[model samples]
Target: MTDRKLLLRVTLGWFLLLILAYLNHFQNGFHFDDSHTITYNTAIRNIKNVPAFFSDPTMFSANPQHHHLRPWVTTTLAVDYWLGGGLYPFFFHLSTFLVHIGLCLLLFSVYKEITGNALQHRWAPWIALFAAGVFGMHTAVAETINYVISRSDVWSTFFIVLSLFLFIRFPAKRKYGLYILAAVAGVFAKETVPVLLVLLFFYILFFEKNLSVAQLFTARHFKTVLGVVGRLLPLLLAVAIVQIYTLTRVNTETQDAGLSNPLISYWLTQTYVWFRYFITFFWPFHLSADTDLKVISDVSNWRIIVGVLFVMALLVSIVKTSARKETRPISFGLIWFAASLLPTSLLPFSEVMNDHRMYFAFTGLALAIVYAAGLLVIRRESSVVAHPSYKKAIIFAMALIIGLHAFGVHQRNKVWFTEETLWKDVTEKSPENGRGWMNYGLSLMSRGDYVSALKMFEKANTLLTDYSFLNINMAIANAGLKRNEEAVANFARAIMLAPNDYNSYAYYARYLVEQQKFAPAKEMAEKALSLNKNDIISLESAMAAYQGLQQWDKLKQTASYTLSIDPENTKAANYLAAAHQQKATVALPSSGLKTSEDYINLSLVLYNAGAYEDCIAACRNALALKPDNADAYNNICAAYNMLKQWDKAKEACKKALELNPNHANAPANLKWAENERL
Candidate 1:
């Protein structure tokens, strides 16, 4: 086959296999970060917000506090939204898949270029195909592909690879503009793009036949080093300025809170983290959306010691092997792997280890493996082919490795199929992970399995202690279980811990309304609205409080506002209906017994206020003028029921039935009164 035809076949095979592996994931809903960055981000709802996305970090999400400067990521989401007209998972997943395929094709091209020019000219196309295959099918990449938000990682990889390709193709000073463009685009996608500079440096060092490492450190090579730096200075400065701007725009409060662990401890923890990352690339069985890795303060810990030795061994091996012309690719691949991992390992992130972090770094590992395999089949003479037996064995080995990785990728997609499955797997794999248990509880709560959800939250608490959101979730579960006091206290604690989170106040307000604490519920709901005016939950909570307080005007206004924003909101629709009904009921009995309607309304207001006896007296006044009024008798019965005056309730129900035998609520009231009569 011609080189072009081979490339086409390999690219198609990569896409087809990738589609089959992640076929089930097209319908998967948004997970953790997707909620904040995509689902709730109202700014991306319209294409008009595109300019705002560039100007303000807050426009990246609905949460004003979640400041992200990744305008490219948000712009892409806006494009998706514009194309699909809303939050469609299929479109998002499809876009991500396309980007992955692009990355794979790019990888194949770069590999073919590198391998074809090597000292031992092997079947370069085959080497490129297998390397790209390994990377495209690596199970660790499942997190990045399935997660719509982690497209940031994918986007960064696309630019990083493109920039390297450009640099490799055009290493002269004049063609640096295209390289700078790719790097800048990458920086907009993610801050880690600056590492491309180091990558370019390495590529120039090993591939360009420039100054070798030994000579560069001595005085004689100082001028050579200066020449290289001068050539790349413009590209380096552009990336550095972009990095600085990106850093300044980050929300420091969130960053500091996430990196609460001391810097030294975080650095030490990454030693073992690198070890975990390496094994996952090859074996890839142990994977979780979230992991519970502990910090290793003790340098003598077994895992840390092993990690140290592994790094030392890898460096020594790469150096020793680099003398052989055939092993240069392996040497460069090792360096690339170490360099790619440097940013995530050295920096303190909220997570100790994230599978998506391996997305870019895995390419280097794949390169090393593929090049080593090529060595087994490639003859020393550029024109000669290897023996059939050696070729067959090498091909079989490559097939087996790629097959395992493909299987893992397919299985891993199932874990990311839903929030429930993802978190459940996390809990099972890392039982001590508090966030995993908490997220699992949230998934259960979404399914309305409150009892089970409560158990998960309680388990999470045992491990995580007092995170504000955890407390908020616990409060929600308690409210579900009718553990009112505990729910209220937990909500209060959540508010105290993270006073600015609108969700805590909104949920607490709803719980307060359930407990008939209308005053506090109204207060909390207003506070929640103050925090996030567009919060639908907070709007609903405030409307519920208004309904309970019989504040018809406020209820009508709040409900209408909610309905205008979300026309499909059932709660807002119900609230609006009740408000209108109450308003009409208040304006009733225009002549003889107008006082009765007024008194009935007063009785309801008093009943909501928990003044049961006062409500009963008001009902009696309504009954005085309109002795046969069914609503008056029904109101009296409801007040008596509230006071547990069952006999009185039974008598009132009897009168209501005598006045209007088919009164809507009379039979149920009579049954309840009879059952509990004392």
Candidate 2:
């Protein structure tokens, strides 16, 4: 076959393999950070907000604590929202997968260039193909592809590789600033793109100038090194300008990006994290969405010592290989791997390590591993190289490796299939991670398994006492189980822990609205809205409060404002219509309640409205009509508890429980009343 036909067939094969490997992940639901950025974020609900995404950092997330200046990420999310007509996980995952394909294609071009430069063997193209295939189908990359928000890592890495490709493939375009422009675009996608400057500097040194790593330190090549630095000054200046602009424009104060570990310990932990990242590139079986790894505060710890030695070994290998032209690609790839990790290692992010972080570093590791293997094949004697069986063995080995990685990717897709699967996997793999357990509880709560959810929340509480989100989830689970006093206490604790976080206030408002406390619900909703005006949940809560209180004017205003922000909100539209239909004074029914169920329903309405006395009287009337009415006794018990009549509340609760052993609220009310009496 001609070279063009061969290349075409190989590229087609790669595409098919990638599709098969990731097919299961296309419909995978959003996980973790996707909640704040896509699910609840109202800004991306409207395409008109795309322009605001670039100018306002807060447009990145509904949660103020997560806001950052990734305008390109937000812009793509907005476009996906527009195309999908809502927050469809398929559209988001499709966009991310397409970007992954683009990144893999770029990786092919980059690997080909570096491989051709290192070894002028006829198999350079095939080696590049193998490297690209390994990276494209690798399980580590699957973590990033499956995560919608981690597309920032993929996009930024794509631009970095694109910049390198342009610089290598089209030297003439350097003067036109195409490569630098790619780097600039990457900066908007993610702040880690600045590492491209270091990458480019090393590329020019190894490939362009054909300089060895040792020559830079020798007196003979000092001028040559200076000239390389001089050539990089323009790119450096551009990167610096964009980085400074990002730093100044982003609201760092609002972001809760800091690690809980002390600075020294965090840095030390990263040393071990690098070791973990390195091993996972080769053996990805231990990947976790949330790791239970902790900081290494002790400098003398064995893991820290081993990690330091591992890093030293890698640096030594890079230096040793850089001294030879045949191994320059290996050295350069190692440098790429190390440089890619520098930003995350030096900075103290909330997470010490993440599986998706391998997306960038593994690109270079693939090149190194493939090129080193190719070198072994070429260095073999002519008899061995020409042996048909040997070639078959080599091909089979390559196919097996790629096939295993593809299979691993498919399996990880199953793990990421839904919130329950994902968090359940985390709870298993990272059992010590309180956040993981809490998130699993949230999934159970979402499915209305409050009893099981509370068990998970209680387990999480033992691990993460001060974690505000955990407290909020605990409050929600308690309320779901009808443990009213415990729920109230958890809500107060959550607010106390994270006073500035709007989620606590918004969730509390929702609970209050459910309990028919319209005034307090409205107040909490307004407070949450003040923190984040674009929060749709808070707006809905406020509308519910207004409707419950029969404040038609305020309900109309809140619903109108919500509709203005989200034009396709059917709930807001319904609320606005309800407000229009409501009259200032509606006449009550002229006839008195005759059926037991009717009196019981009236008691529930009165109980929710805080008219405890009236609620108890209605419940008594329901009992008079139907002596065996368990719901009436339950209502009376709830009303008495609300009124702080503990003895009466306990008596009524016991009677309700006696009539209906499965009475959900009776046992909780009885327990509360008994505790209060003590």
Candidate 3:
């Protein structure tokens, strides 16, 4: 085949593989944080207040609410809003799919450069294509691609691969600019890519050395070196600055950094994650969100032994191949795999093993596999080191591994259909996992079966004690059952357990407002607002408290600000209009010909507050809003009789009974009105 035709064929095939992957994940809706972080999340969907998402991560309406400082992720979601309105996951998935295809093509080009010979020319492109295709659809990537909010990881892969492709283009100097740009972009993708950057620098310094200050900056000449630091120094400085920022934003949340067992314990668990990736690399399985790693409480655990054996095997292969004069790309691949995984492999981070974290790291292993295969194919072309039987055996092994892995990926992708199914499957498979219990609680809660939801939370609390989240939510269930005292105690306990949990504080403050503890209710709102500057719930609560206190102007501003964060908030808009009229100190209309329903709602609020005239005026407004609303007329009649407008009230009650003879309240109030009619 002509090289051009071959390239076209290869590219088309690469695209088809990604198309299959797209269909798989597209059939899957979002899992994990997709609801709160992207779709149902009010903070991310409103495009006009885009800067607010960037400026403040916690967008609970109150400025003091907790939010992760991940503006880069939000910016992409904001753009998604502009292109496609809220709740559409299709465009988001399509975008990531296209990027995945582009990444494959780039890997093909990089492999072509690394194998600069006639024999490797054809084999390298195909090998790289296989690697990219497998990685793209590798079922393990569902967490990063199928879960719409995980575009950050997909975005990072594009840049990292793009930078690598450019670094391999003719005359590496010209590609230096692209390299820096890609690195900067990847830095925002996640804290994971810098490990790749440092490893690449080591590779260029030792392996790809062309010898100049710029070349020197990229070189890895440990034994006989030239130009190394000046070109690298500038990029290193930029990376350093970003690192400091990430550290400030991420590091200070020390408690959140969470528990890391002994270094030995971590190292032992890491083996299971690594081995799991390898197994999935060959055969994808039940693929879950949170996976428990096999532990090594003692050196006796099988994971430690297996992991050491694998590491030693790779080390021996690299050293033995170096003595044979073969290029060290396989060694580079192993190191690349190992190095790219360092960030995720370290002490406690999220969990012991997340399959998605294997996305980029799989490439290193892919490279090792493909390169080893290429060596077998090109055995006739002068091997820097040769053994025909060994090459044939490696080829069979590679084919067998790929077939098994493809089956695995296909099976794993099926598990991502929906959250309820996913977590239900997890609970069945790993009943002891605390997170599984918590997630199942949410699924049950969404269905509104509160009793079952409470039971799930109770089980979850057993696994992770002292969790305010479970307590606060449990309070919601108690409230549903009308167990107010129990609800209040639980809410208070939640607040005490997590003082920073503004949600519990705002909700409880709402309960306090209902109880007429206006002063204490207002105090709690102020405290929550102080902690989370733009918390929407707290802002509304503060507005409610001020409304109770008759501080109209302050209530107006708080309600208006709250509505600005959430433009579709009808309740806030109504509150704002009410506050505006109240601040004007104008007499609320009591005798309006229409406005009955509004009057009814207002009357209800006023009657509870013991304001007779205001309640009377509210009924008048409701009747005006709907002249034939007999319920409003009846309410007005009751208010008027309370105010001793006896004749008018009696006449109003007659009008109410005329609408329906079964108007019980109308007859009772009408008798009272007639008793004192003047």
Candidate 4:
């Protein structure tokens, strides 16, 4: 077959394989960072927030600690939210699926550029196909593909490859502008683009001329080297400008402990981490959504020794292979792996190893494996398609390898099916990880398994103490279990640990309301609202606390504010009606109130005063003023019930229930009227 036709056909095959491998993931729930980054992130609720996403660093995450200038990533998430209706995981997963496909296609384009030169542009399509397919199916990338927030990695790598493709496909002055723009976009996508500068330089030094550093300096290719460096200077300068901006934002908002380990210790531990990265590419049997891998404190550890030797051997092999004309692609692939990992290796994050970190680097590993196979076939002195047996063997091996990766991808996605399943996997795989246990406990709490959740929280606390949210969750579990004293202590501790955390305060307020501590609960709820005005949980707590305190006006105001934010909120509607009802029932007969706020409130007062006809007339007035007022429907229900109008009362109550499913008294009132005799 012609190369063009082969390329198209193989690309189509890779896409089909990707679909089959990832289609199941479309139903996967949001896990880990998805909660803070996408689920609770208010910025994604409106596309109008897109501009703020660029201007406000905190727009990217619900958690202030995660604030940074990842506007492109946040903007895409906002697009997903607008498309999905709201927090429906389908659109988020679909976006991730599409991104993976895009990365695969870009991988094909990049490999075609890199290998087209090395393989005389003959077997370039097949090599490109192999590399893209393997990388796309590799289990190491599943975390990025399944977790919606990890699009930072996806987009960054996409633009990095795109920049490289542009530079390779169009090296002229006109195309350089577009290339530089892509490089800049990549920097905004993630902090990994600076490494692209080195990758571009190495590409020119190795594949473009098929020469080593020694050969380039041997007088023949010195000017060529200088020319490549001069060409890359503009792109490097652009990346540098972005890096300064990104670093400033990251440093400003970074609330996490700067480095969990010393710089030298973290650097030394990356030796084994790189080895682990390599194993994941070839055999990803030990993939986990969350890992608790330890940092290597001692350089003389056996694993570090083996890892260093393994790395040295790979570097030596790359150097040896680059001397041969047919083996330069393999050398480039090995170098690509190390270069891609350079950014993560240089910095120490909270986690020593993260599977998402391998998403881009694994591309290099896949390339090396595919190109090495291609080189073996070439070394056999046979045309790629001439030797039927050799070609069949290579095809079979490729299918087997690709099939393994596909199976792993499919299995890995299943673990990400829900928060419970994912965290359960984390706890099982990394038992010592406090965060994993805590998240698992949260999942349990969400499931209403409060007793079990408390146990898990207790276990997690042994490993990690002083996390404010953890204490809040533990308090919630205690409240659920009816351990009021324990609940109060934990709630107080949570508030002390994180006074600014609205959730901690809100949940504490909820617990206090349950204990009938109305005044304190109201105070906590108000504090929570002050911290975050849009916090719906705090708003709900405030409404509940006002109801418990018998502060009818405050309850009505809080409920009205909540309903303005979410017009369909049943709980707020219930609170609003209950507040008016309580105020009407408790007012003195001799009270000389001048005017009601609305006809609904007047009807409520008249109904309580036993003026049934007047109450009915007032409700009619309310309905005339505001036709769909659920509170008016509920007030009429109460008035009809008082007048022994069974059928009328039942009808009004049903209407109220239809308008506000959360009207707490409507169902009972309707049932009472339905059972009454005519």
Q: What is the clash count for each candidate, in the order shown?
A: 0, 0, 43, 0
Instruction: Return whichever of 3 and 4 wins on lDDT.
Output: 4
Of the two candidates 1 and 4, the one with more favorable TM-score, higher being better, is 4
Distance from true location, Cα of 283 in model 3, Å: 2.7
* lDDT ranking of the models: 2, 4, 1, 3
Estimate every model's Cα lDDT from 0 to 1. Answer: 0.78, 0.85, 0.65, 0.78
For all the candidates, what are their Cα RMSDs to the real structure? 15.0, 16.2, 12.3, 10.1
TM-score of 1: 0.79
lDDT by residue (89-183, candidate 2, tens digit) is: 89999998998898889889988988888888788888898889899999888899999999999999999999999998999879998998999
Summarize candidate 1's per-residue lDDT along 1-678 as a digit string, tens digits: 887787677668667777787788888889998997888676676576787776578767666566778999999998997677577888888898899989987888787766665644437777878888889988788889998989999999899998877777665744639978898989988878877877777666566654344554779867767777787788899998887887687666543335556678778778778878888876687788888887778888898887887788778766755655556677777777878888877767767888888888888878887787677556443333345665566657766776676777778778888889999999998887999999999999998899999899899999988789999999888888888888889988998988878878988888887788888999999999887776777888898889888998898789767754443354664566567566423322233223567667656755665657656765776776578789888878887887888998999999999989999998898888888873
Model 1 clash pairs are: none
lDDT (Cα, tens digit) per residue for candidate 4, span 291-372: 8887888888998897788888888988887787667777777887888888878878667888898988887778888888
- If both were scored by lDDT, which would come out higher, candidate 2 or candidate 4? 2
What does the lDDT come to for candidate 2?
0.85
Q: Candidate 4: worst 10 consecutive residues by lDDT?
A: 588-597
Off by over 4 Å in 1: 1-7, 171-176, 251-257, 321-326, 379-387, 513-517, 543-678
Error of 4 at 50 (Å): 0.8
Highest TM-score, which number?
Answer: 2
After superposing candidate 2 on the true structure, give the runs of residues whose Cα lies further than 4 Å from its correct spot: 2-4, 381-383, 580-678
- Looking at candidate 3, the ten consecutive residues that score lowest on lDDT are 59-68
